[model samples]
Target: MFKKGLLTGVLLFGLFFGAGNLIFPPNIGVLSGDYFIYAISGFIVSAVGLATFTLIVSLFTGKGYQELMSDLIHPKFALVYLVALYLTIGPLFAIPRTATTSFSIGIEPVLANEYKGIGLSVFAIIYFAFTYWLAVSPTKLLDRIGKVLTPLFAGMIVLIIILGLQQLPHSPMNVASIDYSGAGKAFGSGVLEGYNTLDALAAVAFSVVAMDTLKTFEFKTQKDYKRTILFAGVSVASLFSVLYVGLALLGNYFKLPDTFKGNVGTYILSEMTQRVFGPSAQVFLAVMVIVTCLTTTVGLVVSISKFFNTIYTKFTYITYVRLFCLLGFMISNFGLDTIISLAVPVLLVLYPITIVIALLVCLHQLVTLSKVGIRLTMGIVTILSFLQVLSTINGFHYFKTVISLIPYHDIGVPWLLPAVVGVALAIILPYQKITKFKNNAEEKK
Candidate 1:
């Protein structure tokens, strides 16, 4: 039982970590400057905290994200929600991000200025082509990404930080990056950046994979089944916290000169690795990025394609894989900065909606929540998220003004107070829906 539990934990770690997740911590670390402590704290809360909560929702409920969400909300709504979720984390954003991030951090530093554009173009095509092959083919090599490469990649970050601190002169922490000078702003920025990782949202969509894998094992009892899953969830959270904090801490040590190039987060790790381990680390980083990102990209494409195929069997898995890889290839050439800039706002909107659902779902499991509360809370969240998006646009001061009326609106999550009211109304109102848990009695079997 113990061995199986630990093994499940290890497996979960691999599934959770990816090249796409590796960038944010160090970047937040760099940008938050002197306020890094507060920044990292907020980051871990949203990134690690919410993702762990998501897994628990899956385990305790005994329904994968889709099953549980479909029961609570409407199936059609869950389907639409999932489609947006998958695309944002799949071909349109994350799949392409894996390529651009790998190239910018791992490969671009070695290329001459004249060749960088062509270099990125060539790298993206080759990256997605390999992703397409791996998604459809499915190899033992892909398994190594989770079991082997993930550990090595994580260890490399730890090793670089330890070695660099000992060998390299530390740059004194100075002014915070543009908007991060204030502690509140830094922490809020960190929270928003945490949304960028998409781990929390992915946790729900990817819960199917984890729960399915757990089901394959024979546990002596229901307790054992739950224990094994808890082991997996806790282990992944621990690993993520250690890596994210370490990466963020290391970010403070890099001296950003006027000549510093590329994305801040990507550059910190790449530059730090180069300084600590020298030119050889560059080759290793590039190869690791390509291999790991390829595996990550393929996994995303496969998951996304499979879900779409499941919904509409008219398209074969291979066809969807090819389509997405082609899309990812075309989009990745827009570069890392462009990909991130567009993706963050979309994430900001999606994350809170998911978080509210996860929160209400967890709360409901403890004690039944009324449909009114659930519906009201979700409704307020959706409207607030829309306003949050509009408020960020060029000609939307009124949207900003409406959101400003909400307390704590300045700290990035303008939805909190309204969401609280919606939850409060649920408790006050007596409209109980007697919602059934899709897996309550039958899950253990």
Candidate 2:
């Protein structure tokens, strides 16, 4: 049980610790400056909140997130959720960002400007090709690689924290707004930015994988499974909190130049490593980033492939796995920046819906909400989410105007108020009871 729980925790950590996450918090620290403490507190709340919520839902369902959603609604709705999740986590967004960020942070600095693009292309091809091979086999090689890379990533991150702390007293005063005009608004913005990590969403998506790990270890009882998941969640939460604090502190101390602007988190790490560690810092950082990113890519590809394989049993699992890898590679070569910009709108649409679903699943009993009620609420929310996403992506002035007139943005989060209202209505609505009186009346016929 101990071994199984530990392994599950490691895998969960790997899934949650993507390249973008590594880059974001530090940047938040840098931006928040003197406001670093407030921002970090808010960031930790969202980060931990999402993880805890998903863990609770997964534990109760004893099923994958998709299966849980299917129970609440229909199989078709579940399928839609799965597709959106795969697209968001796989080729369209997170997967590509891993490869691109790895190259940019880890490898690009060491190369001459002229060859960097070509170098990144070549590295990506090799990276995805290797990812494809492991994903198809799912063998001991991938396991060994994960075991090796996990420690190395942790060590490098720790080294970064140590270096940043050593420089803190020597660092300049925070010029950026630490105490903004509105405390509530500042905290809320920080919390929202933390949501960009999407660890919680990934937790739901990866919970099945975690559960399977438990089953593999011969955990036959429900009690054992619950304990294992709770342990895993606690372990992941601890690790994330420590790392976030470290990175946030690093960002808080470093005063970046104007050119060092835009997602300054990655730059802070890169520059700090260069300053303290010397010329080899680039290589060290690159290797760590590449390894971390590669592991993430392989995991995502495998998960998505498994999902598709279940729906279409005609194709061998290996075949589908290879297909996902190839497709991901094709999309990733376009560059990371492009992939992220394109994915933002989609994420906006899906994230709110996903959050609402997870919340509903957790609160179903108290809400006395029927499957029909859940579906109705989700349907209404999804439509509004779709419009918000469209407006965001296309810069549609008219859509924005329409959204503003709605109760939420005209009132916050277009679907939030509507979902609450829908839930209230569900609880209040009366239905005829299927009682002994009714049964007796039918029997009289």
lDDT of 1 at 356: 84
Q: List the residue pairs that clash in candidate 2.
A: 34-178, 35-178, 106-286, 408-411, 408-412
**Top model by TM-score, which number?**
1
- Tell me the spans in candidate 2 whose CA falls farther than 4 Å from its real position: 1-3, 139-146, 170-181, 365-368, 391-395, 401-414, 426-445
On the 0 to 100 scale, the lDDT of residue 274 in model 2 is 83
Q: List candidate 1 segments past 4 Å from native.
A: 137-142, 168-172, 259-261, 438-445
Per-residue C-alpha lDDT of model 1 across residues 124-233, encoded as one tens digit per residue: 88888777766786433235555676667667666776876675446535468776778898888888888888788777756666665667679888898887777777
TM-score of each: 0.92, 0.87
Clashes in predicted model 1: 0
Local error of candidate 1 at 260, Å?
3.7
* lDDT score for residue 410 of model 2: 29
In candidate 2, what are the lDDT values of residues 1-445, reduced to their tens digit?
A: 5556666777767766877678877777766755666677777777776766776677666667776676666668889888888878887778878888888788777799899878878888888888887677654422644466666787788887887679676442456553332445446556666666766667665766666556556767878877777777777787888988887777777777766544576688788788777878887788777877777777777777778788888998888777777677667778766876787677667767877877777776344555556677888889988887766545587887878777645213677788887666555655521221122335368
The global C-alpha lDDT for each of the candidates, from Candidate 1 onward, is: 0.77, 0.71
- For candidate 1, the TM-score is 0.92
- Model 1 pairs in collision: none
